[model samples]
Target chain A: MNIVENFDLYAPRLINKKELLSAGHRACQGCGEVLAVRLMCKALGENTVIASATGCMEIISSMYPTTAWEVPWIHVAFENAAAVAAGVEAGLKGLRKKGKIDDRYIKVVGMAGDGGTMDIGLQALSGAMERGHDMLFVCFDNEAYMNTGIQRSSGTPMGASTTTAPAGKISSGQKTWKKNMAEIMVAHSVPYVATACPSYPLDFIRKVEKAKATKGPSYIHCFSVCPTGWRCGSHLAIAMGRLAVESGVFPLYEVENGKYKVSSEMPKKLKPVKDYFKGQGRFRHLGEAEIQVIQHKVESEYQKILDKVKYLKAWD
Target chain B: MAKRVGMEVAVAVAEAVGQCDIDMAAVYPITPQSHIAEHLSDLVADGKIDAEFVTVESEHSAMSAVIGASGTGARVYTATSSQGLMLMHELLPIASGMRLPIVMGIANRAVSGPLNILNDHSDIMPQRDSGWISLFVENGQEAIDLSIQAFKIAEHKDVLLPVCVNIDGFQLTHMVEPLEFPDQELVNKFLPPRVPYATLHPSKPVTMGAFAMSDYFTEMMKAKDEALKNSKKVIIDIWDEWARMFGRAYKPVETYKAEDAEILMLTMGSMGETAEVAIDALRAKGVSAGLIKLRLWRPFPFEEIRAAAKNAKKLIVTDRAVSFGGPGGPVFSEIKSALYHEAHRPAIYNYIIGLGGRDVTVKDFIGMVEKVIPYNAEKTVDTYEFWGVRE
Candidate 1:
């Protein structure tokens, strides 16, 4: 049995080099979401079926008569990727049990953007997880409805300017904090729940591989930097994702069976949230007062994870 | 061997569905629709059916899950009604456009305003343009028969469109009736295992439901429309084969005592039976009242509709759902549109009846026909009215 073993970040050669999401696609330059999708697909490989929600990845990867998907992929609609994946998993099981198909281990994957996951898609995702379907749901968190021209979504971070929630003299950007989707999946008591960033390529790949091996529902919330929507330099997309994790605004962590583990080693003193927001034009209007408020929230949330890690530590 | 058994219409419908050798079902429980889902769940639990029964959170997910399962080359099924159907409205087009052969049972109920959960066609009426093969069953026997045939019709290569077998909520679905269950071996022989045109498999990768811009959007819609239009022949073919194997026969626009009648009353769903009784009473009263039961709602059955109304001088179109501010009731408008170009067409009067499950007895049907009796081809009358509304 050729099973993907525990991955080592130091050994790049150990990773599967197959490009399941092929080239000739129309994603923007330095689009971190597409990069994350590409990396996750590499981890999933040929023995997988992806049920993608209608969002940026779906549009860019699949246009009629031409497709970047080298693997079997279905784009159903927004808000139902999890439900669809659950169905796919169940369908495969049914077919295999009926002896209509061989019992080869084909992973069922559901992929969606933040808006598709945290907001409109939440119920389906929750239902799928609760049902314990053998599938993996990945949320590419660009923090807004980027595919619909940077509209504010529940996933949009507080004070982040979007087309719908523009920062003005009379008003701040988005009024809500970024929804903790990975934590929400954990609440569903799924076997595996993780937060990853493609900038940490090894970590992202490893988590996906772990999800692939999982027998029940698994969810991964990926921090996908959007250069175009965020009004940041295209080149800073990867750096932006790394900054998101390092600044404690978005942490690299995993929860296994109700136990939490912070994947990345946090600095003794976390970088100020302003440092994470500095490069992006979306947060350019934020003054010290607003930044301080966001900074406080980030620190407290990050500390909550640390507290969970300290007390609930069970796995290595 | 087939034997008659007394069962609730909903339970029998689920049993009929189970016999289809379906691989998966994702259903949500809603009023008038809960029995189908519950019974199907029991069937799966009891090992009566080898299928995955996903009790979805909402009807939206139910439709989505079925679409996904069907895309994986599995014979999939689902059930919903009224508000549930309304909730599932968005994914309806997606399912048909993707051409997934999924069969669903809809215990028809009125869409809410005052939140009524009784029998009505308001639920399935608005889904007219969803590109699905829609069929209305008049009774328990038809519900069971049609539910089984749905899989065969939907999975047909020519018609890889989703099929919704609509049975009136409470009126038909909740009724206990003696219905014959076809032998499992015979059902398997009649409705062969689904042969999916394309599927999500590792060996053969395909991208379905791709983004289509203006350059290709119209063409994609045209293809879907053409596919639905072409599906009529396959539907008839399957029904014919079903009739040959079993003893029951069905038609898109079925008529009852309409021969040489001047006045024809049109009805859909379980109301057709009542309308028949009304026709008998009207004939006894020396009125030339007849009945036309529209069994197939989608792909509209235009030719059959026109042919059925040809000999009639006046057509009384009864609609259970209000089109609200539009041209009378939905079915009434459809009937008018279907007969618009014909040089010698009947004068059609639309009666919007049974909104939110108001009882439409035989007397009501007789009254509707009698009200339309005063009109003739030469003189114009009110095109439509809310039948039974207080003046």
Candidate 2:
């Protein structure tokens, strides 16, 4: 394994201690999305320009006169972050080729939330990836539209209550499965596609580093836990992410050059999905039958990744 | 030395953009605007121009990509028409508000209920409030000249705003005419490399397009408005410089045979030439008919409009797009609003004509003047009518 893959051993020495996203602006207490952004920025370092979509991260970090971004950043609109990043990449390349600017390799990154990515921004992202711009798009999937007060998004998990898909006398909350954005990006045939969570910072940082080194398009789907949106205690945010990965609800994996490799170690007997849903109020309305349905879906999804890793030959 | 060549207006506009030494262009193909995009793609593919040509999937992405490129301090260009322009409407204000100097070519076409891909000002009429510096061109030569001048006007330090050069679709964009191509050396001398006010650079970190709330929203809007209003001076200065360099003069409002006329007609875009021909015919027949061509639409050219119409007893304004339930024509409404407070305002009449590529002949212009000659502004029940509409 490379040094970044084995970064947990030499993290203090290998990591750049400089923080790109500054401290103390307006992120909620224990906001997993902001935490994931912090780790990703640390891996990106100073040689990066970010195009951020209007979301929780953009709102918290940039508020008129103040800003928390230590590197270059821009927020164009809600659904065009990927398209903007592609423009930045092309602009830089054009400038360098004409000797207008220095030929330093600057990584362009697109950042958005679940609603911006899986829903409104999907077309722009697909076009950018297909065109093969050297950029990274990181979707901070907090399940629902946390920025808009717990509205249901395509990334929202089934049976999870939201403002638009609330559990009532007749409704059982979100009816659809969480969109598999990682697989959707993988289907674009990009150079790198990965799933990560702030619950495992080293693993998440390692994936970001790999994506940064990627020549063409790279996508990272971050499973960010929203304590406020999920109607859970803020202190349990990290713990909830841990529970999610351990219960196989959100598997950690990476697809490099069409080859699948599971990043996290799976238990011989995976933890039950009920354990992941116990503290979250969004899933509290579900009965045993609903829990069983979720549990079955989680097991099968995790098995699909495992099976792909086992069956697919390594591209290298 | 400038050289005159016969070429299609759309291709000439693209070639003019190439002469500006742009850094990037992001365009999506649409009717009447596809030729510009095609030629630009070929220019980049054949290495004729040292630029990046981004073939975006939709007009929204095309506008968004150019915004991003301009934010990164790249000299950028793009083209679209009608439905494509409507798709780009959301980002137009954002581009102007951020003060990104992106220059775009608009092939003015009719918007659809029944889908017509032809010449009209309906495409650009709805974007009046988009905060862009809008310029209308009459023919192929003006199309090429304005396409080159748009970059210089947009990138001026005092006027760092997006500009749209509107050419009538199929009327001017598809027509072949002899156009004078400005020399590269002169264009380079006129338009230097862009020095962006603020750019996304790791060396100097800055935040662009930040969220503005009630505390600062009004102030931000005020800044944008002031910038657009102040751009008129810079626009005139650039036009003066172009005239001195190329011997082809342009103005916010151009007049033809209006010096000693009692009756004047106003027009925009390609219809200006037809109206001028009509004026010549009226003058030969001993009628005091004149023409006022409005080249600048965004700033409204209030002073120029008043100056041109101050001596005339009656002014007929022809519009190619209807303003729906509000007013008869969008241009007529604007001119009425502009002349409302003027002390020496002429009696203005509106004629909504040439909609959806309905050909406006020279005789049609003559007919409008004759139709409105007998009516008095205060006594007439309806001062505006849809001309040439089948009864």
Candidate 3:
């Protein structure tokens, strides 16, 4: 038997065995964030550095003197991941000019949860994007601030129950709709922006791969189903993310240089929004009226994406 | 070899920093600090410097972006004023704790309550414990000189802490003066390219700014403290080298005719020049008055302050920032705290003056000395007083 039977390494392997994100992370039983990050690492390979804002991922992966990251990572402040990524990009540029780094340039990735991206970190995200840092900002949206005990975030969906916005007497839980992070990134006019989910492993990897390939700033809004935060079964996290797309609640799409394309194949008629909402206890309090309202809202948002895609398709 | 050119202090600062050939400059505009950012932007756009100039949405983002850029092992610069500085307050400690050697310019302006935008030490005073080495300049030449030196001080391996060059708002930032712009080759030789301790590089991966539990937090804090406390040696070294290369000299505590004076007056920033005029006037009248300009605000010159105050029977500390409900002013409280344990301490008196762009003249300094004579620094109960407040 040959010691290295699989020595056809000349071909670009789609499934890299070298896990840069690595194991031994302190993530929960069925963490969608870790899975997505794992795939992201697998896509970028070893030539990458990550700037993570303070959140679940930061807390889980980095401990003093013992880090889960096999690659360079930094967690500076709560709201400045994108800003710090901007700095890293500039710093690398300077170092590269002086021939201080390897010729194959390290890819910079900024990671933050929904709260870090949609609320406190919004200004920094906008500024980094506007400045066009040659980096990628990947936002893991688990609906609420999961690291802070499931508090409502700007990305929390309307009718979803969180610790702060619980469904109690005379309360309909979160009154406002979830912030459209992918559309927001599109609005920033970044070179590449996309919606991704860990459930769709290939799609997630493909988008992340595209982000690394794009020259300027790129953003990926990955839907991570937090079982602990969403009051769902630990094993249902992956299925939940799939439902988020299959039911048209979180349609998988991409925007490239102002062109929108729905990457996930949708049926002529998507399954009822209730199929996406019913499994989670956070939305168990919803009545027929509330469910209908959510359904309508989801339909409207999904239609907007479809309209953009059809327009771009027609133009092309 | 150098040539003298007359320019605004802010523009001169831009010129000075430009000579450093920084990698990136993240800027946000606020009044009194606007000209510095505007000029730097122009320099970057016009290819005067091959650096990145990012006009961020806000000062908070400016600080954050610079932090990011600096983390990438890039030489970075930024500028801000009053409310802008206040907005950047949260991330200031993070930058220092991470040991990122980013240089920033503070056009020292008063903080707002009634929304006044003018010159004062109010803006920089509250940031004493933010883990940044602070320096103040007395004039346009000093402004230009120190802006360049700030980067050197900050980038020192022993003192890899961020440094702030606090230039008085419109008083110094707007005024024009002649300064000798040094040769770029000389600057390149003096300030070498940065050697980052650890950065975001995939070649050799390491984690930075990791969360510290109680077990490790104390040690981290102590390391930062020791790095700063020991930085005075580097600061003195940089100043000495600069003086040799150039003709101008600088010191932590610069004295003006204090060699044979009993009543020593202390001031910081541009007020030092005006206080020097008052000292000349006092000497002419034979009142035994002298002036001491405190150039370094952080790593507070405890020993120098004691030695200067040792010979004097009385010392008057003129401050520009109020501490509100506690001590009368920030500088006054700091000096008092420093002198509290001294064996032979002078009768110290503090007067809050020149706040919110209010000017203090030579006569006001002379008046301040007269006011300090009545109150004994050791024996008196009421040591704090405000000067030139309208009735």
For every model in order, the fraction of real contacts preserved is 0.78, 0.74, 0.73
lDDT of each: 0.90, 0.91, 0.87
User: For residues A187-226, could you state the per-residue lDDT of candidate 1 as single tens digits?
Assistant: 8889899999999988999999999999999999999999
Question: Which candidate would rank higher by lDDT, 1 or 2?
Answer: 2
Q: How close is each model in CA RMSD to the real structure?
A: 3.1, 2.5, 2.8
Question: What would the TM-scores of all predictions be?
Answer: 0.97, 0.98, 0.96
* Model 2 lDDT at residue A112: 95
Where does model 3 exceed 4 Å of error?
A1-13, A98-100, A313-316, B376-378
> Candidate 2 — which residues are off by over 4 angstroms?
A1-11, A314-316, B377-382
Worst 10 residues of 2 chain A by lDDT: A262-271
- Candidate 2 docking class: high
> lDDT by residue for model 2 over A117-188, one digit each (tens)?
999999999999999999999999999999889999999999999999999999899999989899999889
Residue B94 Cα positional deviation in candidate 1, in Å, after optimal superposition: 0.5
DockQ each? 0.79, 0.80, 0.66
Q: Which prediction has more favorable lDDT, 1 or 3?
A: 1
Residue-wise lDDT of candidate 3 within B1-391, one digit each (tens)? 6888889999999989999979888889999999999999899889888787777888887898788778778889999999999999988998999999999999999899878899998888878899999999999999988999999999999999999999999999999888788778878888998888987787788888787788788998999999999999999999999998887899999999887788999999999998999899988888888888999999888888877777888888889999889876888887888888988777778888998989899999999887666665568555587798877
